[model samples]
Target: MSIDTAPEPGRTHDVRSADTDPDAGAVAFRPAFRAALDATAAAGVRVHEPGTEAYRRLSGTFNITKAVRPLAVVEPTTPDEVATVLRLAAVHGVQVAVAGTGHGATEQMDDAVLVHTCAFDELVVHPHERWARIGAGVRWDAVLEACAPHGLAGLCGSSTDVGVVGFLTGGGVGPVVRSAGLSSDSVRAFDVVTGDGVVRRASATENPELFWGLRGGKGSLGIVTAVEIDLLPIAQVLGGAIWFDGADLPAVLRTWSQWSSLLPDEGTTSVAIMRLPDMSGVPPVLAGRTTLCVRFAWTGDPEVGEEMIRAIRCVAAPLVDLVGPLPYRQLGAVHADPSDPMPVHEASTLLAAFDLDAADELVALAGDASGTPLVMVEVRQLGGALRTGPDCAFAHRDAAYQLFSIGIMVPEVAQGVVAATSRVHDGLRPWSRAGGLPNFCDQAGAERVRRAYPRGVEDRLARAARRYDPAGVLLAGRGLRTAADAVG
Candidate 1:
């Protein structure tokens, strides 16, 4: 494929593999990639060289992985250039890891080609048509901010800083998911670079197989450059968090589980058990306390929304009732996921339903009186539009709820935290869905992914992978049944 008119004007021959020396590796491919990146630098693409100021900024902003270090970071300006980088990586036998906003980054990639798509950021609104064309590098913040002027919004996940591509690819379930469906469901098209180093467009009518795989494939298929999605007419949200003391956590959690079941599709909510350390960002009252937080988001009319949220709020008097009319940009405060990166070991299992019996059991596992938790134990309500799969290929949309546990691996208690989380998951097995969410898993690999996608869907996705990645060199924990099944 021909390169886009990048300022760096990279028209060099492929680099051959050299010795393991860092200097050798840098001399081998760094200059070529830099040239390509330089060509696009004038086009809003920023190239970060090793040991440079720009490189440090890029690395620090996405320090999601603790061990792995990228050789160099390349921010490509256009889809063609992204495809070129993939082709170059494949030719050089170098692994390529795509980084969006780094919200779901799991591993570090030493000596790998890191493509930071942030330079591709763009959010174009079509209010009258109720649709949007966004760059893959774009974040929920861009969509939320741009759509506000026209009274329109997209289905974005909890943290607005999360990249649109990464979130949507992992099956986005958000506050308004009940009404607008998943972020993937709103997808109209995606411009992506496949493992074969080709840039292709995926839509319902064109490349339908890939369209299905890419939606929930979780970066297993290719690197997306741009996407088009449907937008909703939403100016504001009746959503935020209501915090209760740790002592009232059990009863509050139980009541939330039971009460949320009766909620209509217009309502979305979740319960979190947070043991926040006393820090500058944390509220004084909530700092150093293990608190129970019930978060609510209602997309219906304001009057009915208040009534819907009131049902759960009445379960117990909250120490801090902060739920009310809020702008869409403030949606991150609802979940309050720490913006900083710390070592987090997360596991998730879905429940068939959260009946009263299940609720009691859930509260017992993570309640304040239960024991010291490794980290936060969150129960997010599922169903509603989540029960309905998007028009793409992602599977497992029928789960009732997702039980997510985040255990910080403190030096002395790492194993205990893992054990406690495992015990909790095992205890909830009877009420849990047989599988898990692709996004929530950490190192479970393809066996875990099989549970995420049903059998028929898995077969179809494998075929598409075979078509695009016949050699299996592009494998990065993809849609296959097993890691060994990658090349098939």
Candidate 2:
């Protein structure tokens, strides 16, 4: 909704001015002058800047804290300008942070350049060709709106408010994942600017290494300027959530684990155990109690979908049953994730497979009998298209399931909340996949970064990083192995 189309600033009167021709005039001061000019130019899109109201509007996942304050926010309107900004930043040794719709954001740069790509927003739909070319700044909502008219839809996350580039770059898992695979798996090509400032196009045929690295590898390799991905012919879907009372938690969780595995490839499902706080916006029946919510989305016939979902709905006594036919645009309403952000602490672990023991452990830590105030604990069943790797680059193709825990930080009970969440993770550690989903991993460090990709995939990404960023100016968090160290 926020787009800035402004004219460039006129020359500034200072001690020195950049030479009109870099080869001919004022060589001594032109470099500094150009740097200053670039800095001034970059200030237009900063959300935290006082007078820059547009920049200030860019909110993060947890809006309670305004922690990140960048030196300048740059919104490059074109791929050329994106490359220009990256090159200039590289030459000036300026650190850069790439952001889209700032969900899943964890860290902040002290005095670095933050690239805000909202201006680069563009969505080109090729319905007959079955693909979409989206600008890095585009959100899932825009793409959905564009593609809906043609009976096609892109692979998007649970919430359409999230950005395409950031979501797909992190291996997007959504309602349709079981049938279509992760969002990254749908990527056909990408336009990116590496840390060294080169603007390049990567695909299975072009820059194959870069293409492979970007799919599952987080933003470590470079900033994606544009992405082209395949679309599926799915308009109306049978999807929504069915809620059950707290007393039914044990039956619901156990039944869901077994039921989810039996789901056909056309179906995707997940279960959430929530201890919702008493609040006005919450439904009265579920406001202050632990409840089990089984969410399902069927990409096939509505009748078949309903029949499949009916088995679980009958698992226990129902408190609310809203699962039925709905337009794809109504996807966000299914989960009803909190729109207003707060200080949220999140952690996730992938599983090799979920067995009865794992289900029992999850119930013990977060179920009604556990007395944990953890907002919601979710276990998304992963298989079907998600289990098999497409010919492309995404690496987490073999993960059997994903477990996520989200909790708001209450100052008075912060330590207890942390302990409870840790207990949940520790309980599942025995069966947890050593890796994690990049979209859910929020800790900012090198070790956590490595956990997003497999060892072989990490080594390949490191090699790509070396080929592009030889200077090693970009510091990807946690155990980042540069191209040199990758060789042995």
TM-scores for every candidate against the unseen true structure: 0.87, 0.88
lDDT of 2 by residue, 1-488 (tens): 12232222563222323345221123224464336334536643222321244545553344454346544456667777666666666667666677887775665654455677787788899999999999988999899999888988888888888889989888899888888887888899999988777888989899888888788776777888899999888887899999999888888788777778788989988889987888979998988888988888898988999889878878887999998887886776677778676776677888887777788888888988897868989988887988776543356678888889887787976777788889998899888877877777776656655667677766666777777776554545224553248555
TM-score of 1: 0.87
Candidate closest to the true structure, highest lDDT: 2
Model 1: CA > 4 A from native: 1-56, 59-67, 444-448, 477-488
Q: Highest TM-score among the candidates is held by which one?
A: 2
- TM-score for candidate 2, please give it: 0.88
lDDT of each residue in 1-488, candidate 1, tens digit only: 22222122233323423343232235336665445444434345444555455454555533333433566677778887776666666655566677776666655566565678878878788889999989988888888888888888888888787888888888788877776677798899988888777889999988888898888877777888889999887878898999999888877877787788888888888888888878898889998878988988888888998988777778778889999998776777788777776776678888888787877786677777777555688888888877775555566677888888878778787888889889888878889877666666555346656767777666777777777765543545343635336435
Stretch of 10 with least lDDT, candidate 1:
1-10
Clashing pairs in model 1, backbone N/Cα/C closer than 3 A = 6-39, 7-39, 8-38, 8-39, 212-393
**Can you list the residue pairs that collide in candidate 2?**
46-55, 47-55, 47-56, 445-477, 445-478, 446-477, 446-478, 446-479, 447-478
